[model samples]
Target: MSSENLDVSSELKSDSSFADRTKSVSIAEKTSVIAVEATSTGVEGRSHAAETSTDPLAQPNDELNKCVVVVNKESGTVCDLWDDHFEAELLERLKANGWEPGLKLVKGEEIEETVVAAKSRKIGGLIAGGGDGTTNSIARLMLGSDIPMGILPFGTLNLAARDLGSPLEPLDAVASLYPGRTREIDALELGDRLCLCMAILGVYPELLNKSEEFHGRNWWRKFTKLGSDFFKAFLSSPKMELSLGMDGTKAERVKSRMLIVVPGHFQDDFGIIPKRESLEGGKCTLLVSKHSSAWSLFRMIGNFLLGRSAQDPDLEVKSAATLSINALRRKKVLLAIDGELAKFKVPLKLDLKKRALLVLDPKASEE
Candidate 1:
């Protein structure tokens, strides 16, 4: 199985494919309800024969026995959903799995300092629980390290965890952490900055800013607010003029209002948030909107939602091994690297490197 999208409904018991894997999984207590449940059917599932990555699974290592779990107390899932005994339950599960687990539950302010300190201890693997920003921090810190990352779905979107097919529930995530095989995954690099998932350029982040009002405190992944966000962003988004192309080539450049760079590209279908079938291949697709006019933007999004052809006149689809993006006359551009916003130097080269980071996949072992 590929890892994440598992059904929690009563019908899951009737799913023949999951029979074997589910037998080994010990469901946790219901009293400890998580803010974020697992992904719905068709996302990804904990298939022992993992299907998303092109690479074969690495040998199971005993070194995973020593791990340090870094939890963010400020994340909506942890703060709003988890109970007081959550830490005890997590540690107990790790211990039950034969790991010498050390726990560090810290507030958002101490994440950076705490992660550095934890890495110095030379633990075999680092497990992190928090939002997308927290996931990005650990990815940047431990990018090339030998130790792998195990994710807990405390983020609103939990995109990384969803991709890894790890359990989204708090204890279920910890339960699967040490049991899975470690896999080397791909990531997008920009100068010294690296993004584990996708990156955005232009006014798209404004839509997400308004989305939080609709999201409120219910942190699980949902798209009911996309309509509201689209409406709000349309009214206030500033115009943008950009030039996109590959480096050392002046001929390939094209004008654009926005850019959505994804590793392995999004699924053709939309309405649900876009997902990639695989993130391992050294490939990326640039989804660009040529004009910033309200009508053009509407058509661009309309084509995407309807799952229309990628070769639409208003939207330019460019698949490349590398991408260079810059504003018309600006020296800097606002970039959202996995939901964290920052001003990045223009003429940014978006490069894809395969197996850039090691992560634990919720792979089932033969019983």
Candidate 2:
């Protein structure tokens, strides 16, 4: 589902769809786990002769044998919720499915090392267990490779995992990883940067900046500081004169406070939360907000929250295979790439890599 509003204020918020469930998942003991040996194809666990009727009905075949699960320890779900007991239970389920788990907690340098190691061992499928940023990092490495990837949905929204039809439950998501059909989806690329979800420009990144500070401060301090930052940003919001050029289309110029570009797969019915029905298409949706007034922002958000169309009369929506965004009246502008704030050079170009990444879809092979 799409967010309640396009307010940059909620930019840093992760997916909160399943946040309220407090019951803990009961992890099975290690005695219930099986072990696997690393091989060129994947980790081989258990033997055909030992195959028992008690095993789960959908088990990975030999060609699909080794599945590596790489968890970003710094991710919200892994850091806050995962523990020794959870890890043990997850391993047991992976072993039962004839897959090996390559669990890690590192981000930048160490993540690269892990990908190299997995490739050397010829892993069949790779499962990324973390938030959107972590998922993008791992998926970037798997692009254009034959190795299919899975999503564990440990992030706040788990948007990518949900779009792939993965189960939110850790064990269930893992089991659905293997013995599943692979779906190739588009990944947005801006030179060396890869965007798995959506990209935003203008006030959204400023909101994310304030959000990053809310992590370590007290409630009062954070609230006051955030409030101050919000007013300052709102009062000083820039009306960017942007010229957007799409392939085979004329460049269009508009003055707006923000621009959101997402793959067409993320498009949904009006008033409904935006979700991708299929990842096969090689197109994207561009949303341009024409008004920067407070009332307009509130109205846009209120519409979305009420399950009504949030289309701003001044807003513009277009379908394109490639987009060229240029700040016609200004220089450099603030950009948010998958929620991470940064300064993007003027005249930025975004292209769609259709079917460039192979992902494991839980419902692909379902009856």
Candidate 3:
């Protein structure tokens, strides 16, 4: 049978079981119960339960031994629905599959803590459950380590998960633990800081920096705000002079309204926008758009929606092994990496690390 047909059967069986489990409980209540039960069980009990659960995805495999799951509670509001019952269900699922699930809750500023916990426990694999920012945090901590990482989409954008074709359902995510495929994604290191997703300045970052309450009003409101923000940025025409390097080449000066370096493509309600080439083999992709005019920005948006970025001349795309950025002026620029906002500093260095991360991919062919 074809792979699609096989996957359909498997998906049906999996969905059936999930339905049975949650038939009597609302999604919110079930999640809450799972979290509470799992937490109360403590690490030892939870491990034991995972070892005995009947879920195929949780079944023990040589590849999944000593797996640790690190979660960021603030990743997405939807994750808030994940309570004790949901955790209990997950534990049961893992145990059924003969795997042990080690869960760790993380604080926003406690990236180091999560790393220490994973390392000290000799975890063979790490599961990052959060949004782009949380994924970035876990990836940063696990860099240089041999351990593989799993991406669990629990964010608004979920750019990485969409790119990887990972499972969206909770149990399916746990099942993906067995895929064992790894992709070497590019990362940008600004000075001592690292960014796994795109970094941006100009109108995009400003929209990101807005409070959730303001942007949460409605789709129309968000669109209006974005339009207004773009106009304001265009009127200001604020430009920053940057010294940049591509593929170990000598640094050159470029002035632009926005500079975006992305490790992978990002898709939204609009459509797919192709990103720079793969980051494998220790190379990073840089995209520079100098057009500050309102018309230029509108055309770029149209191009993105139409998936015609390759045909756009104003969009300069380059591949490099490393890039260094320095501000020519004293004024600080707004910076955002992986959707997190910050202030830009001069002399920022970004280099690609080859085969740095081992992430889970469900669509990968089985060995």
Overall lDDT per candidate, in order of appearance: 0.62, 0.63, 0.58
Better of 1 and 3 by TM-score: 3
Model 1 clash number: 7
Point out where model 2 deviates above 4 Å.
Answer: 1-63, 213-236, 265-274, 306-311
- Residue by residue across 3-57, what tens digits does model 1's lDDT show? 1111122110010121232233332222121221112232233122123321111
Mind giving the per-residue lDDT tens digits that candidate 3 earns over 105-167?
554555567566555544456778776667777777777676777776766555566566666
| TM-score of candidate 2 on Cα atoms, chains taken together | 0.74
Residue 130's lDDT within candidate 1 is: 80
- How do the predictions measure up, each by TM-score? 0.73, 0.74, 0.74
- Clash pairs detected, candidate 2: 1-273, 2-273, 2-274, 15-156, 15-157, 42-66, 43-66, 265-276
Runs in model 3 with CA error above 4 Å?
Answer: 1-64, 95-98, 179-183, 210-228, 264-281, 365-367
364: Cα error in model 3, Å = 2.5
TM-score of 3: 0.74
lDDT for residue 183 in candidate 1, whole number 0-100: 84
Worst 10 residues of 2 by lDDT: 1-10
